[model samples]
Target: MNDYNYVVIGSGPSVFRFLPGMQGSKQRILVVEANDFGGICPNAGCEPKIFFEGASKISLLSQKLTGRGMANPAKIN
Candidate 1:
């Protein structure tokens, strides 16, 4: 079996930040992630939540203004 000088758990933001410095090094490195790559913040966390909330807000605003000012309610699909 091969040896690793660094064993990083999860390919999260910190891992990304740490990798740039190891660019030309010959040290063996291993990164392990059980779920989708790029971590939770981009996959199932803050980013997705922000998009969902923004869409929902826009949809609701469109619904509310459908007759008041907007010609039609916006549909989210």
Candidate 2:
């Protein structure tokens, strides 16, 4: 039905930002998102990917530095 004044796609941060600027006005905004509203970064984007990468890096570094100077390197848990 043609009832809404606005039809926003991908309910990401950008969508949230646009709504506030519409304040008090009867905009009848309608947000439609196929994925998580918050988007991919916090869900499965680079932000979360970094943690896994970091852990793998730490494990690699420890193995390389083992038996060189320190007594056994830190193991990845």
Candidate 3:
């Protein structure tokens, strides 16, 4: 049987940041996550929302500047 000194639950952003420091240490660590790692922010949540919002804003701005002396306006793909 394997014994761990530290058991981390949920691989969120904070966990990601915290785990690196634990590396190369003698302590045994185990990470338990039931779903895709990286938590909500990077997995179908805040990050995607922010990215799409930025894209939307840029697309709108491009449309507005299309005929106002700007060439090759930004495109979201």
Candidate 4:
């Protein structure tokens, strides 16, 4: 059960950059990875979801600049 003409299961990064162009090309390639391998946009969807969406857009711009008072409501932690 080790016969493989080509079994790229996927480890992302375009399967290690197209698997060295299928080496010699004679066949028998098997890269089966279940996890932890540059998949899902570098392990879990794009840089921690863009750092929690930039901290929820700076906590909604500091709650809209403290409700237009021009910034003084700092407690978003």
Candidate 5:
């Protein structure tokens, strides 16, 4: 059996922040994660929501300006 001085379960950023302080301590460390190794806020949570909202807003703006910007929709350049 192997012994670990430090065992962290999640891959979240909070746990990773401790890595710098643990350097050269000569202690056995283990990190076990069942999900993706690392995650970014913009990749998973708030950013996607913001992206979808932006798309929805663009759609709404397009509908509102359907014939306002150009005289002929078929002759767009």
Candidate 6:
């Protein structure tokens, strides 16, 4: 059977940071990624959140520029 001294499962920024330390080391290191690298922050959650927030900001800005008056302004109803 194949043997390795270290196996890192997730492919996130932390993994990238840790990779340099493993270089030139005697221990065999293996990185196992089941999906896209860079993890959920870049591939799913955080990035999408940022994108949606930016879109909302742009929509608000456009409404303000056109003097449309807050499109769904908080009504406290």
Best by lDDT: 1
Give the least accurate 10-residue stretch of model 6, judged by summed lDDT: 68-77
Report the Cα lDDT for candidate 4. 0.78
The regions of model 6 sitting more than 4 angstroms off are 48-77
The lowest-lDDT stretch of 10 consecutive residues in candidate 5 is 68-77
Clashes by residue pair, model 2: none
lDDT tens string, model 3, 1-77? Answer: 89999899998888888888887998888889898888877786786778899999988898889879778688887
As a TM-score, model 6 comes out at 0.49
Instruction: For candidate 6, give the lDDT of residue 35.
Output: 90
Clashes of each: 0, 0, 0, 0, 0, 0
**Higher-TM-score candidate among 3 and 5?**
3
Task: Output the number of the TM-score-best candidate.
Answer: 1
List residue ranges in candidate 5 displaced over 4 A.
Answer: 40-43, 46-77
**Residue by residue across 1-77, what tens digits does model 5's lDDT show?**
99999998876677779788898898888989776775555236567667877877767676677789944333212
lDDT, candidates in the order shown: 0.90, 0.77, 0.85, 0.78, 0.71, 0.75
Clashing pairs for model 4 are none
TM-score of 4: 0.34
TM-score of every model versus the real structure:
0.57, 0.50, 0.54, 0.34, 0.50, 0.49
Model 5, residue 13: distance off in Å is 0.5
lDDT string for model 6 (6-73, tens) is 89998887888988887788888778888997888878768666877787887667666664555453
**Span of ten consecutive residues with least summed lDDT in model 4:** 67-76
Looking at candidate 5, what is the lDDT of residue 66? 74
Residue ranges of candidate 2 with Cα displaced over 4 Å: 48-77
- Ranking the candidates on TM-score from highest down gives 1, 3, 5, 2, 6, 4
**Model 1 lDDT vs. the true structure?**
0.90
